[model samples]
Target: MLVIPAIDLKDGMVVRLYKGEMNSAKVYGEPFEFARAFENYGAKWIHIVDLNGAFAGIPKNIEQIKKIRESCNLKIELGGGIRDEDTIKQYLSLGIDRLILGSIALKNPTFVIEMAKKYPIAVGIDAKNGNVSIDGWANTDSTSAISLASKFKGSKIETIICTDINKDGTGNGINLDFTKQIAQASEIPTIASGGFRSDDELEMMLSDKYISGVIVGKAFYEGWINLRDIFVKYQA
Candidate 1:
């Protein structure tokens, strides 16, 4: 599986939120520099999220996002504050490889279906506490994560980014059973996010051909996992 590094933006600064909580965020360095760094380490795809915008329902880091897109030839998959057709169009026009839909997917199932048909290779899902959360993980609804994933059964959704809110940024480990269940239910490739502490965890997931990718944030930034070394091992 391909390992995608995460660059979560909150107020134009790179940060990581534990279990999607704003108060628990820990900031990193410059976002553009981090994007460049990931590219330098041979990353083909970079995952970015606008934490504040996701909650506010507006594009918070458009300027920073545009710079990253223009600076590198690397592909980017962005999420946060993406709600309707217009926003999706705007991001796609700017050339983001994929668009992740969190709260929207769960809140508006009909819109999710229509959007999946309208934009191919432009949709992903992030669920919290086994249920779908909306407004940037600020509110968790009653819908189960698996049920939300099943909504894309016949859509053009290529991959779903599943994050266990509890383990996110905790450096514990991924929710393997939950991920497998979602992967199997959706029958769509999944990108596992959150709580990865070591290369061994990544190696184990890579061994499973069904998993499409894994998003590494705190681990990569805090020197928990070496990108170059992990890339070498996985490549070999």
Candidate 2:
């Protein structure tokens, strides 16, 4: 399994939020520096989220995202505030490797299906108490993560990034059982995100055949997990 690093962008700065709360965010540094550092540490891919854009329904950190793209060679998968074809095309034109659809995937399944046909697209399913949440986890949809994942069966979705909101940024380990369920339901390779706290947890997650990769955020940024050693042991 690939170990992907997450860089959550808020107001053009790299930050991590507790439980997806915007108010609880702690800024790290410039996003490009983080992207470069991850690349230098041998990360094959980087996951970025535009926190400001997520709540606005329109991308707010395009310039910063573009800078990161230009400064690094690592494959980037970006999500948040991406709502239309124009934005999708814009990001692709900027050389992003993949686009992650969250709110729209739940709000308009047909559009997601259509987009998957033309581009390398991944759907992000953020769940709280088994129900999918949208608008940056501020609102809960009446659909279960499994139900939502089941909708993408046979589609060209490249991956399903399943994040457990309760464990997100809490360093409590991942919701492995539910993550596996999402992978099975979607019938697509899934990336487990949120609450990855230790090398053992990462090793356990990597052992799951259903999982394609793991996204490490706070655990990585706060020095709870060492990226260089992880790359040497796992990806190397």
Candidate 3:
């Protein structure tokens, strides 16, 4: 499985929030340095979230994103505030490996399918309260995660990143059962995100072949997860 480290951007600085709460954000220095550190730890793909953009409904960290794209060659999967096709095209034009549509995917699935068809790589799906959350994880609607994932059955979406909003940044371990159920229902591969705390948690995810990837954030930033050793051991 691909080990994707997260780089959440708020005001052009790397940060992480508790359960997607904007007020609980903690800045982690420069985005450039964070990207390099993840790269050095052997991250082949970087997961970036525009926390401000997600809440504001517009791209908020474009400048830093551009710098990271130019600085490192690691594949990037960016999500947050990507509401329409124009914004989708802009990011792809800049060479972002995958564009993850969260709010749009939950609000207007048709647009998600259209973008999936047009973009070479597209990912969608966000979770909350055992249901799918939309509009930047601000609201928990009635739609079930599996049901929503089934909509992309024939779409060109390469992967779907599913996060347990309740578990996010809690370091309580991923919602594997929920992710496994989604993976079983969805035709496309799935990536598990949020609450990935330790090497054992990641190892449990790795054991599941259906989980295409795992996105690590707080655990990596807080030194709870030693990514360098994890990568080296995995390689061995």
Candidate 4:
């Protein structure tokens, strides 16, 4: 399992939100330096979310994201505001390792599947109370997380990132059951996102065959889990 660090960019600043609340952003600093720091911490990947892009349907942090790619060697997988073929091509042109489609996946699963056939892609299945949320978690749909994930089964997608919005940014613990259900339903390699707050939880997820990796945001920024130590133990 990879202890992937996250950098949520909003207006060129790094922030972490509470339960996907746009107003709850806590700014840390610029993103490129943090990407460098994560690389130095032995991370093989950096999960970046453009908070501005997600909510606004525009790439508001492209320059900031470019800096991250220029500064670090960590394989970058980016999401948020990625809606069309052009945007996907643009990001890949800048050397982003992969793309995670969220809102677009909910609205156009076929488009995503077609693109995944040629490009490195992943799907973000953010849910609340088992229902999928889209448009940057601002809207909830009737589709269940598992149901959405099942749509990508056999697609050329890289993975499905299952995030529990209620538990996200709470620094509580991961929703292991929810993640397991999505992974099983999709039968795809899955990555757990949000609420990864403790070492005990990490250990449990590591042993889980269904889970391929995790995205660590609030927990690492808040010092709930020491990245250096976790990397030393898990990266090897």
Among the numbered candidates, top lDDT falls to 2
- 1-236, model 2: which lDDT tens digit per residue? 88999999999999999999999999899999999999899999999999999999999999999999999999999999988889999999999999999999999989999999999899999999999999988999889999999999999999999999999999999889989999999889999998999899777887899998899999988998889899888899
Candidate 1 per-residue C-alpha lDDT over 185-219 given as tens digits, one digit per residue, 9 for 90 to 100 = 88888888879889888878977866788888999
Comparing 1 with 2 on lDDT, the higher-scoring candidate is: 2
| Runs off by more than 4 Å, candidate 1 | 121-124
- Would you give me the overall lDDT of model 1? 0.82
lDDT of each: 0.82, 0.94, 0.85, 0.91
> In model 1, what are the clashing residue pairs, if there are any?
103-134
TM-score of 3: 0.95
Candidate 4 off by > 4 Å:
none
RMSD of every candidate to native, in Å, equals: 1.5, 0.7, 1.3, 0.8
Give per-residue lDDT, candidate 2, residue 54: 93
Error of 3 at 22 (Å): 0.9
Question: What total of clashing residue pairs does each candidate reach?
Answer: 1, 0, 0, 0
lDDT of 1 at 144: 84
In candidate 3 the C-alpha lDDT for residue 206 amounts to 74
Please provide TM-scores, in order, for all candidate models, with all chains considered together.
Answer: 0.95, 0.99, 0.95, 0.98
The weakest ten consecutive residues by lDDT in model 1 span 120-129
- Provide the global lDDT of candidate 2 against the true structure: 0.94
